[model samples]
Target: MTRMIFVNLPVTDLGASMAFYQALGFENNPTFTDETAACMVWSETISVMLLTHDKWRTFTSRPIPPATSSEVMLAISCESREAVDDMNEAAAANGGTADINPLQDLGFMYNRNLADPDGHVWEAMWMDMAAMPTDT
Candidate 1:
């Protein structure tokens, strides 16, 4: 069986969060979504579950960190530099904040970071494997 990853996030507004993700090219999976939670699929093997605070608490008793806190930053690969820029722009156009981190350009790899309305950081990157520098 193929393995899959489901990233669950605690959101303040379910509808707004859904819209924010949708703008970034995620498709909502209604089968796993409802009023309290939404399943936003980025690809066949990757999906993000946006759950309201109440729904999130049911899964863990740990306190939900404030939006300013950063426990982890999720990343996704892009097809090209243009694609990375587009993703960052789309995120900013929506409810997300763009350029949360310094732009990275290392000849073969490029990356941009953005934060969702809930302040969950996401990095969109593009890499050219063939152009990567190799140590002699």
Candidate 2:
């Protein structure tokens, strides 16, 4: 069987969080969605679970960090640099913050950073395997 990953995130507003992820090209899976959480599908193998703060507390004792504290950076791989830029554009247009840092170009890889309205950091990146440099 293929492995799948589910990233659970805490959100203050379920509706807004859903919209924020949708803008970043995630499709909502209603089969696993409810008032407390929304299942956002990035692909067949990846899904993000947006859970309200209250709902989140049920599963963990750790306090939800405020928006100002960025503890994690969620990175997603894109097909090309254009796709990365497109995701950043869509994020900016959908009430999310875009371009937290300058564009990255390392010969074979490029990336951009974006933050959702609630301040979850997401890095969109593209890499050219053929152009990659290896010492080995």
Candidate 3:
């Protein structure tokens, strides 16, 4: 069986977080969603658990850091450069803020950063498989 990845993030508002992710084209998995949390499926292998701050604390002993003070960033890859732009645009329209950095256009790779309503940073990227290195 393939191992799937689940990224749990603490959000100030679950509904708002859900809306933000939905705007970026993710679908919610209602089977695992509830009032305290929502299961957002980005792909077959990638899923994000959006949990309320209080609810999130139940799984961790450490105090939840203020969004402005957090340093961690999540990076998600896309299949094309257009997808990267689309995600960034969606984020901006859905209460999230786009990164201040200039757009990266490296021919084979493109990336843009965005911060959700609670200030969680996410990097939307696209890598060209044609430019990937192959082992002989």
Task: Return the TM-score for candidate 1, rounded to 2 decimals.
Answer: 0.98
lDDT of 3 by residue, 1-136 (tens): 8899998988998999999999998899999899999999999999999999888989997877776765777889988888899999999999998864577878778899898888888889999879976799
| Best-performing candidate as measured by lDDT | 1
Q: After superposition, how far is residue 134 of candidate 3 from its true place, in Å?
A: 9.0
How close to the true structure is residue 16 of candidate 2, measured as C-alpha lDDT? Answer: 90
| Candidate 2 lDDT, 16-129, residue by residue in tens | 989988988899999999999999999999999999999999999999998877999989999889999999999999888899888889979999999888888999999999
State the weakest 10-residue window (summed lDDT) of model 1. Answer: 78-87
Model 3 regions lying over 4 Å from their true place: 132-136
Q: In candidate 1, what are the lDDT values of residues 3-98, reduced to their tens digit? A: 999999999999999999999889999999999999999999999999999999999999999999999999999899999999899999999999
Ranking by lDDT: 1, 2, 3
Which pairs of residues have clashing backbones in candidate 2? Answer: none
Report the Cα lDDT for residue 17, model 2.
Answer: 88
Model 3: which ten-residue window has the lowest total lDDT? 64-73
Q: Tell me the lDDT of model 1 at 112.
A: 99
TM-score of each: 0.98, 0.95, 0.91
For candidate 1, give the lDDT of residue 122.
Answer: 98
